[model samples]
Target: MHITVYGDTLCAQVTATAMAQTGHQVLWCLVEPESREQLAKGRPLFREQGLDLLFADQLESGRLTMDFWEGNPQGLTDAVFLALQPGQHGLAAELTKSLASSTSTGCGVIVNQTTGPVGSAELLRDIAKQIDPRAFLVALPDLIQEGNAFQTFTRPDSILLGCEDGEGEALVRELLRPFNRRKDVIQVMSLREAEFAKLAISGILATRISYMNDMASLSESLGVDIDVVRVAMGADPRIGEAYLYPGCGFGGPGLSSNVLALVDALNERAAEPGLLERVLRTNERQKEVLFRKFWQFHQGSVAGKKVALWGVAFKPGTHRVDNAPALKVIEALWAQGVKVTAHDPRALADLGQWAQGRGELTLCDDPYEAAEGADALMLITEWKPYWSPDWQRLKRVMREPLILDGRNIYEPAFVREQGLVYRGIGR
Candidate 1:
């Protein structure tokens, strides 16, 4: 099937590659001319582990192709998947209008791969119906994670497709025929149900992170080790183990927005249990976990302090810094007139734009370079480089060798033996 995708920015690129990998031809329409130019020059738009490899394969195979459209002037496909962001949260309507105008229309499955809450699908379904009642618009939302979207595409465990009727359902199954297998996870459900399930899952995961952070705080004051608590909690067969490894907090594209949106929607409905409310509150407090610990240790004022920050991205293995706790803490430090030098393995571009005109902030290649002449060091992301560092060399470079390990990826005795004040989350 020669399908035309609206946006081939990042996830769209992955989606197109995934489709083309299965022998289907993909005509990816980028949002901007510059983006097309970048692709033409072979410059990648974003970073991911296995994306570049797949992209190279598809490009060579001629199955994946790129084009730039000034506007969606009108074309058609067997189906259209709106894998777009909530730019003013109005791109859905715009795509629907363009889809209506497309001359070669037919009975196809329009999948909503964008991450959004309930009611977005119903609204899109209504819009598609306005265009052609026969054509089906379903919310076969993508549950892809950052740094792991390609892996999820190649080997998805479950696929929840929401549709208005069986027509959309059957087409969706055919669309994802390459992935569906025995004990098929292609669950067919109502549009509303599937829509909310995505948000609900994210909400629950974020809540788990925040809840762990909350425990970490209590552990600090009560003289109990949160790591011990985590081990005990995960020991339960019913509980299992996942996001219970206590850290600073949860921060990323999907989790942050999804949680906040869920909280707002649930608040408006007045039917939300108090648990969701607490989750949002806890997460908000959780983002400040590292900073709060720093403040208390440094008395009331952090002024004139030279802080070394490790990890700029929200999490390791990716360069997305949307709601990273590292940025938040850096801003707070700047506001209080504290000097900060930060380092990351891969988030230089995002951090560079963020540090514009801020002469105090330095984005360093070497983590230890940032540590030089610093009062304290804060590990915001669990980058593998940070897990094992030359602590003795680090101690020699810094003025005051106090360490704050936010991700809890360090050994206590070893750090102490290195003659450093090592503080960590929970334990």
Candidate 2:
């Protein structure tokens, strides 16, 4: 199969490389010249766990190629996947129009991998029908996680294919056959249903996280451990415990955005808002949990203090800090006349860009270096390296041995035994 993926997002790069690795000819049409030049020189614009090697292998094998999107991109392949971001729906519509106007006589499938609002597929189909009625439009919402994207793409739990006709469904299923080896993993549905399903899944995930965070807050007030309650809840057959861990908050490009998108959709259709509105409010408050804890621990004053942050990324295994809790905590601390030293294995460079022109923030290459001379240490992201540290060295370096375990990765009793003050989410 010959396929063309349009966009420069992580989804686009992963789809193009994965398809080429599976023996398909893939043309990755980047959105700009900067991305094209980066890929042309064997450099990836974004970071993923093993995507660099897969991209290099595919490029060297001649199965995958790159080019910038200029104008009409029709007739380049039998299928065109619009892998643009949520805000790029206008570009997607224009590409559909160009493909429909092309002189190609054969049928083509337009796969909507972008997370657009409902009715977007219908809009694309209507535009494509103006030039060629045979152009098939399908909405295939992506379910890729940021840190573990390649594995998720190659072994997805299920694939949703949104098409109105059998031809489009057949073409998409064939294209995804390599990844659907374990069973019949494709779920066929209407275009609107597919679009809504993606948002629905994200909504449920956000609800679970916010629900747990709410419970964690209650547990703290009642002097109960949320971890014990979480374990017992997971043991039940009805609730198999995923996304149940209470942390500072949930942050990424997709999860919260999808929840808000659903909220907007529901609000437009109904007379009043729904429970998802509260879910968004809860998450926003949770993102400030660490900062609030730090302020209270210091008796409502963090002035002239130095704080050490262990991780800056929203989650481990990637350098994305779009809405990370670490950013919020850092900003709050800085505003109160506090200096912050942060270190993450991968997120330092990105965080440096985000923290530019901020005089109080320092980016450190080593976690211990960040801890040196700091008043308190806060663990923001639960990266593997931050799980267990040399407690003796940490105590020796810090001016104050106060530890704010944002992720609850350390034991309270154990840290107390070591003569270090420990605070967790709900312990």
Best by lDDT: 2
Which TM-score value belongs to model 2? 0.96
**Candidate 1, residue 324: how far the Cα is off, in Å:** 0.7
Top TM-score: which candidate number? 2
Tens-digit per-residue lDDT, 1-427, candidate 2: 7889998788898999999999999899888777877768875677877987898899999999988888867345888889987878898898888877777533368898988899898899899987787778999898899888899999999788888979989888888999999998889999999999999999999999999999999999999999999999999989988988998998888887899899999999989879899998998899889888888988987899899999999888888898888888888888889989999988888898888886567889999999999889999999999988989899999999999998999999999888899999988
Cα lDDT of model 1 by residue, 226-245, tens digit: 88899999999988688898
Compared with the true structure, model 1 gives a TM-score of 0.92
The alpha-carbon lDDT assigned to residue 138 of candidate 2 equals 93
**Runs with alpha carbons beyond 4 Å of true place in candidate 1:** 32-43, 73-76, 87-89, 105-107, 271-274, 357-359
State each model's CA lDDT, in order. Answer: 0.79, 0.88
**lDDT of model 1, residue 272:** 47
**Residue 279 lDDT, candidate 2, scale 0-100:** 92
The true-versus-predicted C-alpha distance at residue 222 of model 2, in Å, is 0.6
Q: Estimate each model's TM-score.
A: 0.92, 0.96
Give the lDDT of residue 178 in candidate 2: 93
